[model samples]
Target: MNTNFNKMMFFYTMMMGTLMSMSANNWLMIWIGMEISTTAIMPLIPNKNFLSSESTVKYFIIQSISSSMMMLGVLLLLINSKIEYQMILTSSMMMKMGVAPFHNWILEMTEGLELMTMFLILTFMKMAPLNMISYLTFKNNLFIILSLIMGSLFGLNQTSMRKMMCYSSIFNMGFIISSIQINSIWWTYLILYSMMLAMILYLMKKMKIYYINQMTLNENKMSLKMNIWLAMMAMGGMPPMIGFMLKLMVIQLMLINKEYLISTLMIMTSMLVMFYYLRMSFISIMFSSLMMKWSMWNTEKSSTWIIMFNLIAMPYIVMLKT
Candidate 1:
């Protein structure tokens, strides 16, 4: 009971901090809110193992440096109000969000965390930094390009599911950063991404899947395999999926703004991301254990829900497009 209460408190603190940062009008308040969220999340990182301990320490060190940079940038902006100060602040927030070039830490750290904790890091923990980033006037095209390139290139060879998700998060961050100017599209992409990620992680956690190879071990569970692959395809922005529609909106927004080059780059890198998602999906569906005769036809309620959720957005996509 005490442990559960403690966890609840930490979650409460984290939520309050994120809300504070998102709602703050001033730089100081933003920085304070970030600090609160960072501190609150620290307690939740460690899970009594060597890897978790290492991840916690790394998370702390990186966050401390990011917070310091943010504070320095805020102070400089207050005094001089230069573009460079804004750049520094923007870079700091990007670092906090684990955008590429500052992204290796997130991959390593995620490998050590429990699925739920990693899910929070990938989704909710990003909210404050994204909100902070939206307030910045300068948007660095170079970071967006680098994020897409690195996220795609690095993810192609990864075997671990955790690391793959980290890379996907990085790639998606590029899209999110590009669409930051349009609040409606940005929030919609985020919400859809979060939902897809939640479903994938939940299924992975339930099935005890940590790597791509482990997926083939569950030979009899076709329903679970179908659920995972469908989620992956949705996340990879396959045509007709909600994710594809979300990306389409972002691309359309970019085109309207005359950012043809970035839009093209986003499309190319998305295909790269889709390659690995297809690879995983194929492995889950095509590969099987030696004991084929022992296979059982079983389905879970969660699997049904997942499939329904993936398709339910189809009508909305049509409405949005028209």
Candidate 2:
């Protein structure tokens, strides 16, 4: 194993911070953990060039501002614990996670990082904040609806794969927030979606792909190409995909509860997002030709464990039992 202290030390610190925040019994401890996580991740941001340095600076400014907002909200709660104050705290966490209007910093920051590092930011860094939001019983219908609308609409024209995925994450978080208001099943939904997302990013990392138009089916084996396309559809919540099932369940429950506006908006945004997903999918598929290549790029086979977990079976089985 490579013993790079810069990588190992910061990575472990990041994990430790996540655990601390998750297990903390009070908001103050959770804040400390979040700050630790924010500080730890900053050092890991790529700095081999000027753009990366810009990313690091933007990340620091955004995180510091969000952290301070979280702290202020918490302080107000301590002084006069009220639902109004709680909204401030929870909204700060949402800002930290880059839900919608607050999401630009992450887009800029992620654009400058290497793919693997960006993957970490997209998946792992948001975990603590997501859980914190879950714990807060946050149920802001307006914010959730806006996130879904803005995420879907903004992503319709994005060429950068990372930006598109970030917008998709914003859209997915709207469902997560909506679910928190409806049921406790967001945990399962989040797990299944996270795994599927990890699968897509892992493949993209191997391919060194950064743009939506760059995924040429001719460059990969038929099986791998189909799987990648399927993963993209899964992210978009196409029918039969685990993401689709999860969102369907959430929307159904919301409708039963008479949250018509949010549910209606959810459906609309989903249909719009699906358009871009199909566009990206078609671009990838149409590029296929019988071009012969005698050589392979990476001969290492994909991990069996990853393939197994990313399959729809896990969540589909849960849906079956439900």
Once fitted onto the true fold, the runs of candidate 1 whose alpha carbons sit more than 4 angstroms away are: 1-3, 81-83, 289-298, 318-322
| Weakest ten-residue segment in model 2 by summed lDDT | 291-300
Which residues of candidate 2, in runs, are more than 4 Å off?
1-3, 47-49, 81-83, 181-184, 216-218, 291-321
Q: Taking the tens digit of each residue's C-alpha lDDT, what string does model 2 give over 199-286?
A: 7887777666779767763376544555566777778878666667777877887888899999999999999888888887777656
lDDT tens digits, residues 1-322, model 1? Answer: 1268787899889999999999999988888888898898888888855699899998998899889899989889778865588888888888898998899889889877988789888889899898888888886787899999999889999999999999999999999999887776788788889999999998888788889889878754677777888899999999778788888888888899999999999999999999999999998877883434235235588887888778888678668667
- In TM-score terms, candidate 1 sits at 0.94
Clash pairs for candidate 1: none
lDDT at position 122, candidate 2: 73
User: Pick by lDDT: which candidate is best?
Assistant: 1
lDDT of 2 at 117: 73
Candidate of highest TM-score = 1
> Per-model C-alpha lDDT, please?
0.86, 0.77
Each prediction's TM-score against the native?
0.94, 0.88
Error in Å for residue 255 of model 1: 1.1
